[model samples]
Each structure stands twice: as structure tokens, then as C-alpha cells.
Target: MIGDSGAKSLSEGMTSMHELTHLDLSHNNIGHTGAERLSEVMRSMDGLMFLDLSLNKIGDNGAECLSEGMRSMHGLTHLDLSHINIEDSAAARLSDVMRSMDGLTHLDLSHNNIVDCGAKSLSEVMRSMHGLTHLDLSHNNIGDSGAKSLREGMRSMHGLTHLDISDNKIGDSGAESLSEVMRSMDGLTHLDLSHNNIGDSGA
Candidate 1:
């Protein structure tokens, strides 16, 4: 259980390793305080390209702190924050973080508390990520309105090849909207919409 204290120690030790490119601290039991410590050291990581902090307990506050650290990480290519207990309250702030990550190609936000408003805020930032090719938003609470907003935001993701929005509150209307968007996504090769409420009319 590498908790908050462990994270602090790790951050302290890695302060001189600015050239590091990949970091995976998944399922480490780190919380808000740990995230803050990690944020402090992240400012020096200009070469970082991959980061996975999935399955932790970094809720809204933790997410905000991490976002602060990510402001300068423009070279980041992949970020995974799945099942981190992020809620809608952190979506807008996280969107700001994504602005600096415009070069990102893979993003995973599945199994969180992002509802329509959160998804809307996140999706808007995604519009600027023209290089994005993989996105996962499964097991959330997004509905039709959120789906429509995401569709609008994803209109420019011509290079996108994989998308997942399964196990949400999407009904027929949302499914239809996503289908329309995916139809135009030229490079799209994979889509996951299972466990939703899509009916035959939407399919």
C-alpha cells in the first residue's frame, strides 16, 4: 500500500530524473495528499510521454492538484486516470490541464463519476486534441445531451481509430448521435457501446 507517504518519498527521489518518459503508479492507494506531492515534481518532467494513475483514490481535489502539475507537460502522449474517483466538479479544471496536453493521442477516463456536465466540459477541450486516436469513457453517467456535445467536440478527430462509451446512461437518442459522429470519423475502427439502452431504432 504505497500511500501518501510513499508517494512523497517517490517524488523526492525522482526530483532529479527530469528526463524520465514513462511513469505508472496505478493501484497505489494514493490520495489527494499524495497527488499533491507528485504534482510538485511533475513540473520538471518535460520528457514525460506516458502516465498511468489509474485505480487510485484521487478524487476531485487530487485531480486538480495533478492538473496543476501537468500544465507544462506538453509532450505527454498518453494519460490514464481511470477509476480515480474523479467527479464532475473536477472536469472543468481537468479540461484546462488537457489544453497543454494537445499532443496526447490516448486518453482514458472510464469508470468515474463524470455525468453530462462533466462530459460536456471534457469534450470541449478534446476538440483541440486533433492528434487523439484513442478515447475511453465507459462506465459513466453521460446521457443524450452529453453524447451530442461529445459528438460536436469529436468532429475534428479524423485520426481517431478507437472509442469506447459503454455502460453509461445513453439511450436511443445518444446512440444515434454517436453513430452519426462515428460514421464521419474516417479512421475509426473500433467502437464499444454495450450495456447501454440503445434500441433497434438507434442501432
Candidate 2:
């Protein structure tokens, strides 16, 4: 668990001599500078398979830097970036990274301020990433339009098994869109849509 202070040392580009397989830097207040520093070292760890930077203050700029770093990281299998302020542009950059990440199995982008455009960008990436099994988009402000875009993209993703879109403002239209995805995605075993505004009308 790399905390805020631990993140600062990483900002100095201290590369581990040994092959690091996993790095968890969640719940840190390290902003863009620290994230940029982390991105610089990502290229050195060729054996890294998992990276968690959840609940950080890394905004769009930080996300862009990390996405740029990911262009060279082909071994990453799991990536958690929940609760970051990665907006539409950052999401777009990450989408491009996802296209090349053939080993990515789990991706979490929940609790961000992503809107419809960001959702669309991610959906485009999802269409090509067939290895991803888990996806979480809870607490984002993705409304019906975003949900629709996700559904269209998910139609081709037969490997995804778990998905969470709870606590969002998705209304009846969004629920309908998700229902379509549920129908098409037979591999999915768990789905959460609690606290959404998909009332009786959608059911």
C-alpha cells in the first residue's frame, strides 16, 4: 500500500532493480507531479502486471501522463484508477492505451466525473479489448446517453463477467440500455445497478 509519502519518493524516478510485478498506490493525495513521476518508472518495470492508483487526486493531466506511459507497458493485466478526476480527454487517451493492452483483464474507472463523451471513448476501447473481465463505472455522472453507448460497445465483449454501474444518475433509458447488454453478454455473472433512477417505468 503506497501512501501519499511513498508516492513522493516514486516521483524521483527511483527504479527498482528487481523486476516489480505489482504496485498499489491507492488512497494517496499525490497529484499530477507524483503521477507523472510514476509514469516515468512504469517503462522500466517490464514485468509489472498489476497497478492500482485508486482514490488519488490525479486529474486529467496525470491520467494523460499515465496513458502515455502505458503505450509501452504490454504486460499490465489489471489496472485500478477509481475516484480519480480523469475527465473526457484523459479517458480518450486511456482508451487508446486500452486498445494496445492485450493483457488487461480488469479495469476500474468508477466514481469519476466522466460524462457521456468519456463513456463513449471508453466504450470504443472496450470494443477491442476482449480480455477484460471486470469493469466498474459506479458513481460517475453517465446518464442514459452514455449507457447506450456502453451497451453498443459491450455487445462485442463476450469475455466480461462482472460489471458495476450503481449509484449513478442513470434513468429509465439507461436501464433499458443495460438490459440490452445483459441480454447479449451471457458471460456476465454479476451486475449492480442499485441506487439508480431506473424506476418502475423501465422495468
Note the clash tally of each candidate: 0, 0
Q: Taking the tens digit of each residue's C-alpha lDDT, what string does model 2 give over 107-168?
A: 99998988899999988888877788998998888889999999987887788899999887
Model 1 lDDT tens row, 79-130: 9999999988887898978987888999999999999999899888988999
The best candidate by lDDT is: 1
Candidate 2 clash pair list: none
What C-alpha lDDT does candidate 2 achieve relative to the native structure? 0.84
- Candidate 1: Cα lDDT at 79: 95
